[model samples]
Target: MKIMSVFGTRPEAIKMCPLIKELQSHTEITSVVCITGQHREMLKEVLETFTIKPDYDLNIMKKEQDLFDITLNILDKIKAILIKEKPDLVLVHGDTSTTFSTALACFYLNIPIGHIEAGLRTYNMTSPFPEEFNRQAVGLVANYHFAPTEQAKKTLLAEGKDPKSIFVTGNTAIDALKTTINPNYTHPILEWAGSSRIIMITAHRRENIGQPMEHMFHAIKRIVEEHPDIKCIYPIHMNPKVKTLATTILGENDRIKLIPPMNVIDFHNLLNKSYLILTDSGGIQEEAPSLGKPVLVMRDTTERPEGIEAGTLKLTGTTEEEIYKQFKLLLTDKVAYNQMSHATNPYGDGFASKKIIEALLQNKKD
Candidate 1:
């Protein structure tokens, strides 16, 4: 069976790379990878980390590329590959434009789609900004819904998706940790963050870009000012606007380092060393807990609620006051911090790739 795995962006690459390797190893399946390069530079690091040289590179990244640009560009470029290979299944992950557009193209080509990390829902489309809509849209056409948790599968069932088509394979984010985390890993950042509590920052959600983003920054800035024993390292996003805001607000603090994005290995190592994680991102919510680091999500909602339910995450929302209170509590209250850090991860057991393959291969005969 021929299977094409299509993904773009750092989160997708990190999660998909492990699954791609498993697909390649499955004797019954011929795995092919196509990258949309939704995140060119950040995506590259993960691809290299996994040793995945893509069969196709759309190279769609541009200056100030919007959702329309990414969607249309991937649609135009990926159609030809679909036509040529005509794979038995086109696999897409999560709710990125690359996932939705590629799945849409496969739908047009009459090829089946297998959605990884499927059935996550915030219900509110405006909060996650297009992601909620994207995943739901993928749900509409997906033949196989590879949900990462039982709760996610329940979301699919509630949405009226076929029970026969849904597979409760745990999140591939946990699977990725097997490859990323290393005890011997060391970097200058770790050295600088030595002995002091490292508060890792990764806030670049589309909805949190304006006042919400400023609020998040102000809260972090205040926390840094008050807590002299801790160092905050913000490996910022590639978006120029995000960089400008991050610099203008979170800069000037010698303890706060606004570094460019690090590779997956470095990022994972940093997370492993971090005392706390503050983010508006999704992947970090899952990854940090496995490393025994507590995460404070600076957003109103999250699709991956299992982390919060498992006690590893606290949704602080995008407000200066609320974020400060939660963050400060985690730092000051060792009991609160330990409870979160020691909580078992509800995401996966590092076998999501194999489970996804088993389910796919079982159904491939259809």
Candidate 2:
């Protein structure tokens, strides 16, 4: 079976890279990767780490590309590829515009779609903005729903999706850790961290811009000011609003290093070295738990509630006081820190890629 795997962005690439490798190893499955180039430099870094050169690169990234630009560019570009390849199954990951647009194009062509990391929901579509809608919309057309957890499967079933089509394959994000993380890895950032604790921060959610973001930064700034034994590394997002807010609030601090986003290998190694994580992103909620790093999620709501249930994450709303309170507790309370850091990752056991491939192959057989 010829399976065309479609993804863009660093998060999609990181999760899908392991599955792509698994697909290529099987003689019975022909795997093709198509990158939307939604993110140029960051995406390239991830691809190089996995040694994955895409069969097709739709260079869709532009100066301040908005949601409309991404959707249309992918729709226009991916259509041509789909016409030429016409794979037996088209696989899409998570809830990026690439995933949604690619799946829509496939549906238009009557091509089968297999959605990876499917059935994540906040129900409040505006919370995660287009992402909540993107995943739910893709769920409507996907032939195979590869949910990350049992909770995800239940969500799909509750939404009236066919149970037979839904498969709980765990999360591919966990599988990625096995490949990207290196125990012996060393970088200048690690050296600069010295004997002090490293607090890795990644906050780039669309909804949390403006005042909400200011609140998060203020919390971080307060923590840094109070705690001299800690250093914070924030890989600022490409968004100008985020950058400006971060620079105005966090840039002045010598202890907080505002660097460009790190690649999968470097990011994974950094996560391994991190004493704690504060984020408002989705994938990190899954990734940090596997590394035994306690995460304080800087968001009001999250679709990935499995981490909360497993005791690896806590939801600190986008408020200055709330974030500061949670941040300080983790630093001060050893028992609380250890409990969260040591929780079992409900996401996967590093076999998600194999299971997903097996499901695909079995679908072909059936």
Candidate 3:
């Protein structure tokens, strides 16, 4: 079986690389990797961490690229590769423009598509910007739906996806944690944090860019000011607007350190050492729970409702007042903090990649 895996961003690479490694181990499968280079530097870090070198790199990223540029460029470039390789199956991960475009190209060529981390839905098109739309659109045409949870499977069933086509493989994000997290890892940033309680922050969602971002920063500023022992380490995103806004509001504080993005290995270890987390990123919601870190999701809604139900995540919407309340509650109330930290991680065990590959092999046999 010729199975080609396609991914673009850092988050997608983190989840997909483990599955790619598993694919390479099987003599029956010819695994091909194609990267869109949508996230450029950040994506490279993850690929390096997993020791994966793509067979084809689209290199479509450009300065200030919009949704139109990403979607159109991927369609234009990947079509030729699909025709040349003509794999038996093309696999795509999550809801980036790369996933949607690759799936569409496979659809045009009549090649079967297997969607990883499938059936996630917020049903709100504008909240996560293009992501919600991208995932739903991919679901419409995917030949196999590898949902990470029972809730995701139910969502697919309700949406009329065929029962036989869906498989409840645990999330590959959990699979990634197995390889990345190191107990002996040390960094200069951890030294700087010292005995202070660490609060790791990652806020770069498109919908939270302007006023909502400012509000988030202000809340963090207030928290750092009130608690002298708490230190915040924000590994800022590559977006210039996010950097400028974050610098303007949360900068100049002694307790808050705004730094560049870290590699997945370092980031996972940091999460392991952190007191708590604050973010709008979806992958982190699943990843943090495994490290026993309580996460406050800075969004109005989330597709990963399993985390919330499992008591590991709190959906504190984008507002200064509400965010401040939740942040304070998590910090000051040890009972609340212990309750969240001790909650079971609902993502998966480390065998998700194995299960995903088995599903593909079984389908081929049938």
Candidate 4:
């Protein structure tokens, strides 16, 4: 059977790359990759790093893009590719607009779609904004749901998704670690961290752009001032709005190195090197725990509650005092640090790609 793997954006590529490699290795499956290049440069870097040459490229990037442009552009461009290739199944990852739009296009063509990292829900639609809506919409149209954890499976079942169609395959993001993070890996960022405890920070969520992001930055700035031994490396996202906000709060801070977004290998390596992580990004919550890196989630709510329950994560919300208190405690208290870092990873054993492909092939036979 022919399976078309579609993805866009950096996080989607990092998570989906492992599954794509697995599909290609399987003798029974014909794996075809198609990139809706919403993130043109970053997507290409990931594809090259994974050595995945796309069967089709829907280069849908524009200089100044809005949500409507991305949705409509992918719809028009991918429809033709789906019609021409006509794969037996379309595999989409996570909750990006690309994943939802691709699934919608496949649904329009009467094709079966499989959703990877499915069934993650915060219940509140407005928290994650478009992501919550996108994933929910895909859940409706998807023929197969590859949930990352038991919690994710429960979520799908609670939403009344068919149990038989849902497979509790662990997250593909964990699988990506096997390919990307190497023992011999070296980078300028890693070198800068030196012998000091590296606190990796990534705060660029849409909901946390203005006051919330400022609150997070201020907390970090205070941490830097108080703890001279600790160093921070923030791989700032590409959004200009986030840049302006970050600049305002963290400008000319020597201890806090704010760099551009790193590629998949670099990112995985940094995550590996870091002592702890602080972020509002959804994917990191799943991926970080597997590396034994405790993630202090800077959000009010999270879809990945399994991590929080398992002690691999802590939700400190967006308030400055809350963030500062939690961060300070983690640094000063060894018990709190060890408890969080040593917790069992609720995500996967880095073999999630194998499980996902096996499920797909088994279904085709059935």
User: How would you encode candidate 3's per-residue C-alpha lDDT over 1-366 as one tens digit per residue?
Assistant: 999999999999999999999999999999999999999999999999999999999999999999999999999999999999989999999999999999988888899999999989999999798999999999999999999999999999999999999999999999999899989999999999999999999999999999999999999999899999999999999999999999999889988999999999999999999999999999999999999999999999999999999999999999999999999999999999999999999888978899999998998899
TM-score of each: 0.98, 0.99, 0.99, 0.98
* Residue pairs clashing, model 3: none
Q: Of the candidates shown, which would achieve the greatest lDDT relative to the real structure?
A: 3
Off by over 4 Å in 4: none
Listed per candidate, the RMSD to the true structure in angstroms reads 0.9, 0.8, 0.6, 1.0
Error of 1 at 25 (Å): 0.9
Candidate with better lDDT, 1 vs 3: 3
Better of 2 and 3 by TM-score: 3
Q: Score residue 243 of candidate 4 by CA lDDT.
A: 86
Candidate lDDT (C-alpha), each? 0.93, 0.93, 0.95, 0.90
**Which has the higher TM-score value, candidate number 3 or candidate number 4?**
3
lDDT value for candidate 3?
A: 0.95
TM-score of candidate 1 against the unseen true structure: 0.98
lDDT of 1: 0.93
* Collision pairs in model 4: none
Q: RMSD in Å for candidate 4, one decimal?
A: 1.0
Tens digits of per-residue lDDT, candidate 4, 273-294, equal 8889999999899888988898
- The model with the greater lDDT, 2 or 3, is 3
lDDT per residue as tens, model 2, 1-366: 899999988899999999999998999888899999998898998888888889999999999899999999999999989999989999999999899999999999999999999999999988898899999999999999999999999999999999999999999999999888889999999899999999999999999999999999999999999999999999999999898999999998999999987778888899899999999999999999999999999999999999999999999999999999999999999999999999999998989999999887887789
Model 3 stretches with alpha carbons more than 4 Å out: none
